[model samples]
Target: MNYPEFLSYDIALAACAALAVLITLLLLKAFALRHLQRLADSGRLHILRYAEQVVSSTRLPFFTGVALLAGVSQIKLSPMQDRWINYAWVVILVSQIALWGSRIISVAIGNAVARQRTADPATATHLLLAGLAGRILLWSTAALVMLDNLGFNITTLMASLGIGGIAVALAVQNILGDVFSSVSIALDKPFVIGDFIIVDNYMGTVEHVGLKTTRLRSLSGEQIVFSNAELLKCRIRNYRRMQERRVVFEFGIAYETPQQEVERLPQTLMEIVSADYLQTRFDRAHFKGYGESGLMFEVVYHVLDADYNVYMDIQQEINLALLTVLRERNVSFAYPRRMVHVTHLAEPQESAGQAGKLAA
Candidate 1:
């Protein structure tokens, strides 16, 4: 064929190929959209929804490959154009492959970790740390792959990156420290997501552990974010780990009660605690001493559960039981009282003195 004719043929072939690829992409998009709509309508096809996501993710890479092949087959270009085409093809292919691979690997790792953690339920913080770590590793791998495919010596690039990273770390030392501390928290498993923890004045449940900061949902329903570095520096109290809750209560008895009964009160209180189901064990009961208005006893016991409401209920039951036992034993509770004495011989003495004066 003549040169002009060959050129025209090449152009026509390329255009046709491009058109076909476009048409296919549109059809795929429509199919995916229809699947999504169906899933939404059913509200039970979670698997189908996931399939749609997978299909959608491949659309970009699929179109890129199609376009590259079409261009190579239809273009009879100069050597320069040929090289350009080759370079473009290599760059796009490497980058797209790296991206898709990274995503797939990330998802797979996450799923495996999640499954493994099912037996040993992990907290939200743990899951967050795992996810963030996976993403960082994935993206780092992708970046390295891209650079290597572009003919850059990875050894030199890696060395340069290391040096640059060191400088950046020094610049943001506090942030880096927090980030590392977050990792430590995740590994150490100091507190879980739903655990109620107190750090200095902040008391809350952990909502999320991010790269730089940890989010807490306070009891008051406000969200607070703290740097992991700062959090680690503070003294933390985790209430979730409490094995038992201790309660100490003081009760007053009337001072009119016999001294001997007051002395025996500690033993009686101990018996009451030991006999109660709500009270785990009797720690101690002491006749602490006299109070301003009554005799005082200090009662101490441990609750079996650390739950606040449960503790309260148990305590209430114990108190009521003690009161009932005291009533049945005819023991009156103490209250403040005072007695007064007065001399009254003045009126008689004055009458006698008046009678003596009249006789004189």
Candidate 2:
């Protein structure tokens, strides 16, 4: 067997060619990314974002393998060498495909989530979970494909995995429940981030939504975390949705005030409430009825703004104006009082003399 002294020079030449090709591919990738980034920066082809993502995740292994094939034509190889090269490339091709496919799923889901983020931030969390699930599925399926291409029977493997997956799910059932509850919370819009809510007895602004729990920033400046399932179960009072605040206040006037003045009390209250014309709407001002010590007047108004500070400001102004006007009208604020009659009491001096006689 004249073993052909196949010179090592041919192998060296092939190695050099493969190295050159890999370097060229890398430079091309860098240049392509830079160009794509420019296109993205131009702010015109918004579609370039997805393209950039593809190029970004894009690996050169596939091209590297292809470049290695170029050297194959240059060499006189044994059947064993050729077969080994073929198998190696086949594995590379599968990996590259899986890489690209997974990236595409991620990019698409990211874009979808971004669009939904602007339209509705609540949906973004749920969409993020969906994106994660999709990526997992894609990569797992890709792994199966890779194994199958390597001459393994995936039918039995998939069947076995199905049972294993079920067992794993059961083991983490509580965690999974919370995860799904977060999705449900996002979809249902129970309360979005930044909303001030009172759930059961806990009151706070929602800060973040997580797979297991939702976090809140309480008025006391502490962060409160609630399990998504428990949060959903609790009754939520969303004060963030309030448009206006209805306020009712009552005051008393001296019973000695004239009947005419008492009749005029309702008009005075209307004037007082309307003093801050822009912030409040006078609902009703009534001389409600006689009280134990005085005449009671009830005033009802609606603050036009949802801000607590604004409500307080308007109420304070009304109170100041009412006090001034009531004084001008000689209307005195009433206080509780009682009168006791000394109809049958002995004089103090006579009582003292009687005490002295008893002592003697």
Point to the candidate with the largest lDDT.
2
Worst 10-residue lDDT window for candidate 2 reads: 1-10
Model 2 bad stretches (over 4 Å): 1-21, 57-126, 217-223, 249-263, 274-276, 279-281, 285-298, 304-356
Write candidate 1's Cα lDDT for 1-360 as tens digits.
Answer: 998998888888888887787677778788887878688579877545445544556666567576656656678778887766766776666666655655564565456556644454355456657766776776687678767766789999889989999899899998889888888888887776667889888898876667788788998999989888888888889997899998999988876787777777788778777874554778999988878878888888888888888988877777898789778767777666776798776688899999999999
Cα distance off (Å), candidate 1, residue 246: 2.3
Going through the candidates in the order shown, the clash numbers are 4, 0
Q: Which TM-score value belongs to model 2?
A: 0.68
lDDT of each: 0.76, 0.82
Candidate 2 local lDDT, 1-360, one digit each (tens) = 233545667777888887888788888888989999998999989878777877788666577787787677468879988777777777777677777777877788777776876577666766666776777787787788778776778999889989998999999998889988888887788877667899888999887787898999999999999999888888999887789999999999998999999888899788878774658988999988899889998999999888889999898988888898889989899899887887888999999999999999
TM-score of 1: 0.73
Evaluated at residue 142, the lDDT of candidate 2 is 73
Off by over 4 Å in 1: 1-16, 25-53, 59-73, 76-78, 109-127, 258-261, 326-360
Q: How much is 212 displaced in model 2, in angstroms? A: 2.6
